[model samples]
Target: MPTSVKIFDTTLRDGTQGEGISLSVEDKIKIARKLDELGVHYIEGGWPGSNSKDIEFFERTRTMTFKNAKITAFGSTRRKDSKACDDINLNRLVDSGVQVATIFGKSWDFHVTTAIQTTLEENLNMIYDSVQFLKSKGLEVIYDAEHFFDGYKNNAEYALQTISKAQDAGADWIVLCDTNGGSLPGEIAQIVGAVKAHVSTPVGIHAHNDCELAVANSLAAVQAGAGQVQGTINGYGERCGNANLSSVIPNLQLKLGYSVLSDEQLKSLTSVSRYISEIANMHMPINQPFVGNAAFAHKGGIHVSAILKDASTYEHIKPELVGNKQRVLVSELAGQSNVLVKAQELNLDFDRDPQKSKEIIEKIKEMEHQGYQFEGADATLELILREAFEGLEEIFTLESFKMLVEKTANHAVVSEAIVKVKVHGETIYTAAEGNGPVNALDNALRKALIQYYPDIKNIHLSDYKVRVLDEKDATAGKVRVLMETTDFSSTWNTLGVSSNIIEASWYALVDSLRYALLGRTRIEREDKDQLEQLGVVNH
Candidate 1:
């Protein structure tokens, strides 16, 4: 039987320490609920002793129900000079109303002498006193031996004594911290093994990623006897970040056969990861293992060919296991397999026309030479295929558009656009104001077209990014614009490239509208197809 490794998530606590990450108490509450749905063993609410916000967090969630996770309060040990019974930090933990308390103290002699200006003996007493005080309050205590790896390397005997003291103080769990994040995996495994020998308390590992090895070190610790893994989703924390439980959880359950989240909850990993990143207003790295936009994106023709026959040839695990799907990208580097797969993914029936595939490949190569990249712009590529296969009639034609920007002393800058378009062979003229040139154009064009296509009102641009294709040309360089549009249900990426920035934006913007116009889908593509099969065209 595999060991059930307890997952302690600190996204609300340590994760908020990451640069630019600021979560309102409401954001923390929402994240806590989602974490419960994901079935983690514990959720650290934050240090109630530090601020009013953390206290408010506990107060807000006091009556909330969680099925799988305990709300744990985080704080440091008693002050060096204060008795545990008289310490404010200790008393705050007891008053926090949470059943669990995690407290950290100096495990490294260097930190005691140089960082905290305390004697080594006093540091030991701090760890022991804090754990005992919390235990006396009938709270389950987890002692974090901060910098245990570096401390172990400096003075192995003293490092052993910290956890030994914590165990003697009746701490429920002894978690070793690689706080500096500089220790290699071997050092982590060896030190954790030594701690296992020194204590009867269950062991856990909390690793940081300064060296990009937090996940590796965490796995090493578990192999060497740790039963709990502490981390945040997408590795959010101070400095580089903490170990990413998004990667750690899958690695533990799938590779090491450790029982963590259930199979059903495991499948929600990708959605949960995206949910947190969205709420944080941060972007998850596209290549993050197991649960990123490009984790399974195959672009190489040969790679696509191999994956078509056997996904395991190119993929380590089934992407659906983590709620992500394989995406076939077409570019100048693409081959026939990429074209076929991409066409199928977009539900475009090219009828397996060999000549058509060859033509499309050449066209994409030519477009790439012009700085147009279809790989990251699926909606634009879909529009291209629609033109190729069906001789798709233009839904609307742009007659002309003009933009104006004006500024005066002691006044805000203003932007406006005038647009003329022919929809259903009827000329419509409209003008609108917006925050920027592109926004004005979008608003003006949308104003002209929404009367004909009401669903256009539902689609809105979510993101826009521009890149210089030739920096040597400087101000005259061609730029590529990528735009994302979403209907709050799904999103599509469209792009265009031109020497004129506004021209590039217009191309992407038009493709965005065209894609939405063709399908008008706000639900899954399969559902849209089912509705179409049932003769529900107006929807």
Candidate 2:
């Protein structure tokens, strides 16, 4: 059997170093609990000696129990020329009350002389004494040889001596760090392989993503016999970020035949990635590998047409292996199959009518050429499908609408809208006030129809976005507007595009309420399996 790779997650420690990433002690505790549930081998809770917040985190979590993960503390090695036993940082490791302690010491000769101003011999002693002192405290010691790769390239003999000292001092894990994150996969493999012959200690890799090669470097290290992989969820860290464990675990377990996570834990990868992003208050990048919204999305005509016949023609692995699902997107780039597949998934009765399919595809292509994209507007797409095939009657016919924005020197700007509409052949005129023209329009429309559809009071537009299609067109550029609406339980997106920004906002605003009134009921009755597979709701 192949050696099992240990996963050490450092999101709470190294990850928070990234710009705009600030987690409170409560957030750190939440992440630690989730990482424990993720079955990671170790969770590097922050450095207790460095800050009051981390000290509080260690104190609070000292009594909490984790089934699979050992809570670990991160800190630097004892200061130069100091005995490990007398060091405040080292003693804080013992004080942090964790079973495992990870201490990093400089490995690069350049950092030793130029950065730390320490003699080469003392750096080695720092590595040795720190690991030994922690081991003496009955804590599992993970000695991170900071800048190990750069150190090896610049002074191979000295770098080898540093870890040799840690190994001699009984460090439980000797992890090689690509601190600069500049080493390529081949260099990583070659260096780790060379170091393997010199040390009897189990090896590990800690890679960053400055060059976007952290995952590759980690895998290369493992392939060369490293036993552990240290990374953070979603690659959160300083600089480019740390190696993304969401991608690394799957690559090791599924692609490379390595055992890193259990089958059930592996299946929870996508949700875990998003859950952390939510708690961290960061939007998960849509294109992030494996866990991103676009990771398995297909939009091109040829790809969609092929995947419909056999998904294997395009996809490499079943998306469910990492808890992600395959999504088919429709646009001007779509083929007839894209229309047919998405329509069926939404339970639209196209009835296999080739001409109807052709006409719909043509309309979509024409609209996309005019800057209308259906990719994020499934609600709007449903409205189009209903109008074409079902001939669904309009909820209300708009007669006319007017908006006014006014400001006085001493008072805040105010917006008001007047709307007229014929509901069930009875014309109604109403007006409303709002902070913006779009809000005012939405209010006036609601005022016009609230009596007919009392449920409209329960729904509100939660998000509104506008994108200019052509920069060169300048002020005349066509604009696209997307409105996100929710009743708190479920949310959906609607879209509209036109050269007139107000017109675009009007269309999307109207569709959002129309979906709340009509399309929501119709979309819910679709085939469950198809909806689940193709993804009916996009937010």
Candidate 3:
């Protein structure tokens, strides 16, 4: 039988410490529920006493039930020379009323001396007292010895003593933490091996990604007999980041055959990763391992040709296993097979026509020459296909648009824009003022279109990004704008490119709204198809 490895996820705690990641109480609860569903052995929520939001999380989460996961409350150990039971902060950890307690203690001499202003001996006493006290209260104690790797490197005896003290105090799991995130894989393995030999309790490892070696170090520790892997989902943390359990969990189970998540839970990995990213309002990293946009995305004729023959030639694991599907990107470098796969993915019935495939491939190549990158603009490509197959209904058209901006004496740059659009055999004109020319133009167009399509009231631009096509300075310089919008149901992103900023912005903005409505239309169409199949459409 393979060893059973416990996966401890800290996305709600450590991951929230990542730059620009601040979750509300509601956000934390949602993420915690997802993590529980993901089959993580332990969910390390934030320090409850430190913030009201976290306090609310514990208060609310305690009432819920998790069939497989335990909610662990995280905090630092007792203060120096303070009895754990007497320490107010430690009492707060107990009062949080969780089944598990994960407390961090000083392990490195430098942190003990400088950060905590305590002596080395006092730090050991703090670890011992905290774990013993928690155990006395019948809580499962997980002692995370902060900076353990560096502490072991500098003062081996001191680090070993800290681990020993936690074990002696009846800690259920003695977790070695690389708080500084500077240790290499070899050192991690060696220190973890030494710690395992020195202690009888289950040993665990927590690593950060300062040197971009958190994942490697975590695997090394597991090989060295550590039973638990501590990391945040998506590798989110302060400074660089912590180990990513998304990669760690799958690698451990698939490569080493160490049991972590169940096969069913593992299949939800991609959805879980994206769900958290969406709630946190962060763009998911396109190259994130196992479950990213580019994880299974293939391009280039040679690679696509081989992938078509057998995915295992380039893929390490089946894409479906991680809740992700293989994607064939259409670019200038792509071949006929790439387009065919893409068309298939879109469920377009091209009838396996070689001539039609060649034509689409040529059209993509021509679009690429015009600074229209299809890889980043799949919605646009879908629109192009819809127009080609079913034809498009142009209910509205932009006749002309212009803007003027000037600096006033008391005010900053003043801007006004006028838009003339023809809709439903009528020409409507609108003028709007804004902080900038782009804003003015957007407001004017949106104001005019709301009357024609009342659903446009649900449409609002959520995000906008502009990128320069080339570094050259001249009339040849082209710009691309990506726009994201949300309707009542879902969000969609589209892109446009032009030498004129207004033109590019308008193209992206118009498509963004249309894409949202189009998605709803498709969902309705699918529902109708199901109804027809069941003979319920007439009803």
Which candidate achieves the best TM-score against the true structure? 1
Error of 2 at 539 (Å): 36
Off by over 4 Å in 3: 113-119, 351-353, 404-407, 411-417, 424-436, 439-453, 474-476, 513-539
Checking candidate 2 for backbone clashes, the offending pairs are: none
Write down the TM-score of every candidate.
0.95, 0.92, 0.90
lDDT by residue (229-331, candidate 1, tens digit) is 9999999999999999999999999999999999999999999999999999998899999999999999999999999999999999999988889989999
Model 2 TM-score, all chains together: 0.92
Stretches off by above 4 angstroms in model 1 are 521-539
What is the TM-score ranking, best to worst? 1, 2, 3
lDDT tens digits, residue span 1-539, model 3: 12989999998899988999999999988888999999999998889789899899999988999877899999888888778889987888889989999999988888899999988888888888888898999899999988999989999998899889999999999899998899999999989889888898999999999999999999999999999999988899989999999899889989998988889999999999999998999888898989998999888977988998999988999999889988878889989878767777778766745777678778888978878877777777777766665566665788998888989799799888899999888999999998787789888988887787677778877778888888685656799888877764666678888998788988987777566656656777789999999889555
Off by over 4 Å in 2: 424-428, 447-460, 523-539
- Please give, for residues 335-434, the per-residue lDDT of candidate 2 as tens digits: 9888878888878777757798889899999988988888888888888877888777678989999989999999999999999999999999999999
Model 1, clash count? 0
What would the TM-score be for candidate 1 when compared with the true structure? 0.95
Residue 288 local lDDT, model 2: 86
RMSD of candidates 1 onward, in order:
2.5, 4.7, 3.1
